[model samples]
Target: MKNWFVALGGVLGYFALIFLYTLGAYLLVRSPPWFRYLFGFSSLSIFFGLLARTFHWASVAHIVLAESILIGGGTLFSLFWAFFSKKRPDPGGGAQRSPEERPGKSDSPATFLPAEGGDEEADLPVSRVREEIGTLLDAGLSVLVYGPTGSGKTSGVLMECLRERQAGDAERSILLISCSDGMEDYDLLNRPVPASPQEKARTLRAMAREHPDVRIGSLSRLFGDWDRAEGPLRSAFRRAAGGERLTIVFDELNRSSVSALNLILKVMDPVLGHYELFDFTTGERLSCPLDRLVFCATCNMGEGYGQTRELDWSLLDRFPGVVFMDYDARLEKQMLMDLGVPPDLAGRMVHVALALREAHRTGNLAAPLSTRHLKNWGRLVADGADPENIAPCLWVNRLVSHDRLGFPDKDQVHGIREVLGRTFRGGRKS
Candidate 1:
């Protein structure tokens, strides 16, 4: 017990030595600022020595090897601490954007909103999908915004719609729905989570009879039982009086269940004049009144990722308009700038993003660079994260390999460092 106490005292003495040395470093090394770095180096050297002895290092050769390990270990530890703990000039990262900075806020040439002279009746386009839905929205048509995952298809569209909702009438609103499950199937019929097809259909018909103009907000109540009807029925009178039109956003359409697909088919039934559902309890039919709903679905068109399935041409054509949503480097950079990334840094990062996308296209990369990655990478850089470490922390470690055998492609993984070097340092920095 006495020996143990003496050992602990020695350990404390060693730490005290490091602390004193670090304090000296902080006072003396001002040019490059090697304070905590010196502490890390000394601390790691001590650790390496202890580790070597624990492995029974006693011979001169083993002791020499341990000393060599300590020097290399110390250098690595010092450099790592220096990079990880690096501070930025402004912790906020960049200048905040004023209203004048927004694309539509000025008439100056710097303004980069869509060139003027749009149709008087047309709503502004959020993305390419706007070309179809923006012009023909009032025609009661539904649309599918198809694209690669994490491309901002749904988020961008929803943001614009929400913006419109703020200015538009109470009658025009967008609802974000989780249709990955067969939500429409169960909810449309007014059945519980596991109700049979007939029970749901029957309740839907009863609810349909009373509701003249179907409003989107009351959709939840439409699927539950009210004892008098199959599902909870909102006052049809209120819906008619509101005269509200709905735009439904079905997120992750590719992951939707079979039942959801069936409900979608019913929505596409133009001959019915409204979206209708089958009811078994009453042997009657339920339908959304007036057919005033607009549907917008976001999906990944390609296979080999997630639970994506190929849409049949017949079902696909039911969606008269489709748009491919992909990454826009300019918009992404602007978003990063908005999120507090300095302009030059944002541009460099975006350059890397475009380069990565190109690499993915030309088969140099295993996975495509998505907006999500760009945003995360930008934020990390803004917070003073070293791109060398941040790159792997954000994605490399988290990604599943192409073959699912192990790590992602070696060349692709190596390219991340090369990309970061060019992007962050303007070129390789020592």
Candidate 2:
């Protein structure tokens, strides 16, 4: 009988904890007055019943009745709270308050913008791509990712870094900057630039709260108004290192002119490992204490895009490692499928894209199909448009016409057909 009572007590205690936790959640969710009252009454009943049973003040029948009432009442109250609670008014008229308006806002770490689909743990379809990146990072080698638009290159890098950041490596920082000249002064240091300044500031504050050490800044801002000859670039490098591991990514490095290459030289120079240059604005220069700094740059290969005056050997020699991001039909198909494209359609699309690329590469067609063109074509096809009926002219217009392989009067359609034939033949053999 003693052991039975103890076991009963344990079960009751567990239920009590559950009820209290539910009540706490209800209070947080701002349950309605009636619902709150119901919980209060149920809690009172349970407490008295438990006390009465322990003291033998009531019969077993009385204890059973009290528990039934408490459970029934609590269930009804919780249901009512879930279905009928009225939302509270915005504490400060919904006109958009700053992060400072909320109490203890800074105490909580900043939350990242959830992954693209709001699922933090969903695996990316490009496992091979992820594997390659993991290898580079593990080897302590910087990686330069190159892919056409919509290839998820930027998202992949950011997502991987985010996972690493969450793994408790607090001293590391990952910085991403756009190659655009006008993006200076934007607080890209911590948060991405949302469509408006308010969003940008909110994100920055959130980032500051969560990852206070991870600094985001623009390339233009880093070099803006600083004399290249006076070593502004070197100063920025020291600040970035700051006695910890740093991963600096330059997105679309080729978009910037050859002038930007000079900045690259300063950051990559072996001598920079010894001492830092002082920034004129901040008046601080010190040796970078950290031994690990990874420099990665992304750019379009010199094939389709207009050449930004060839980088001299001095600059080229700095980046000894390069990862060629060639077009991968299988990878593309997998990516499309992950983005909700049907398997059959994705396979067909990838087939056509690769065929067109091969035709162009072998000089069998007047103009090779660039990744940009393939992406546009994929979008159109995914939208249920007939790929064959779409104007080839629309795509050709987007290509660098002056640099096109055989534009204006070449047999472009024939080239596309020949590539399709070869792709189909290969498929049949398989």
Candidate 3:
């Protein structure tokens, strides 16, 4: 009877030891706050229990007492450990600093705000943009501005140049070209071409008088015919460069075809004489210049708009700077206000615009909306048209379906509704 009773007690103790070991293993994997204390106590209990039995302690009561003391002490130690392990708050109060600054230091003027908006007091004079045209005369480096639509990139850069020109900066000159096929040719000249020779002369005189330092030209004029200059369109480039420090702005670069893009890369190559020859009238070769010109190109991120073309890796490498233009809520609101949008309406419209963008990103929508759509929508809302009254189904039709601008139909609105239903719940949470 005595031996059997001892065997039973040993079996119980053995099971208890296994249980404690398993618990420790689990605690190690998860390491939750509460488990820390539980593991510590259980481990100490197992250790004391084993020690008491091995030494043949005086009685069951004495063994139990030892186990309890060890468990209690371990629990106390775990509490102390938890206290020390807690993460402390940062000394800077969790403020974000720019990449260039030290952890606690503030950022510089150029780094802190958007490039368009510098410090109020030290803001670069708008007129300096034109003067800086001469600054690019030597063509130190080509610039690439990558931003979403409505980031004020084209307007900001061009406006600054115009401001400089107005300030009497005669040495600087610029040429703006749009690769987009949708833009009208007359738009390039900033007016319609005259039908009569007399009218044409007048237009030319006005252009020279207004923009004396700058000469407005287009790629179409340089090439004469787009289809004919298929194989390495080089001549126009050579003439455009002409050893002058010229700033060339190429907007909507993604609209250009792959072959045209490659041709551009070849033109930009410094090793090759920074110009090319194109076949002109009378079988003569026309040389286009580019060596002394600063090239600035703009492109959109590939977010499902058909306008974007896949850029070749080699072409991407030539342009050193790629600036990402993201949507800034604060700036968007300010821009809306500047456009005569009511403050309240602008705030709400921006929120909806951001929500729609997020929905598209998450695969809840079929197409991405443009900044122009958001601005137009906000304008309509500000004009006293109820947003809810606008057909919910038309969202996709108006913004996503066709490249051309206008309102959407019923089926399009349904698609938008489906997307909104899946992604948003009253615009409060996603």
- TM-scores of the models, in the order given: 0.55, 0.47, 0.45
Q: For model 3, how many clashes? A: 25
Across 1-430, the per-residue lDDT of candidate 3 in tens digits comes to 9999999999998898789788778767778766666676676676777687888865778878877787777777777766675545444565643222322112111112222222322321222332343344223456666666665556654345444543674443566666764443223222223256465455666766776675545322432321222221232244354543455667777777664575567656655444443233334443444444556677776755567787777777876655555555555666667777776556555555555565555544445455565666656656666554452533445444432345443233444544333223333221
Overall lDDT per candidate, in order of appearance: 0.59, 0.53, 0.52
lDDT of 3 at 21: 84
- For lDDT, the strongest prediction is 1
For model 2, residues 206-292, the per-residue Cα lDDT tens digits are 666776665645432332332223232443466565665666677776665444555455546656345343343345444564345
Put down candidate 1 lDDT per residue, 1-430, tens digits, no spaces.
Answer: 9999999999999899879877766666453455445555656666777777777767657766776786677767767767775443323355543222322212221122222233211311234444454544545567777776677877765446444543655566666665554444555444544656587667777766788577533643757544432431122212322565566667777676676676566556655455544554456654565554666678888754657667767678878677776675667777888878877667666666656666656545557668888888888888887755677768764332354566464335545555554445544111
Candidate 3 local accuracy as lDDT? Answer: 0.52
Pairs that clash in candidate 1: 190-223, 201-278, 201-279, 202-279, 224-232
Give the number of the best model, judged by TM-score. 1
Cα shift from native, residue 424, model 1 (Å)? 1.6
Cα deviation of 401, candidate 3, in Å = 8.3
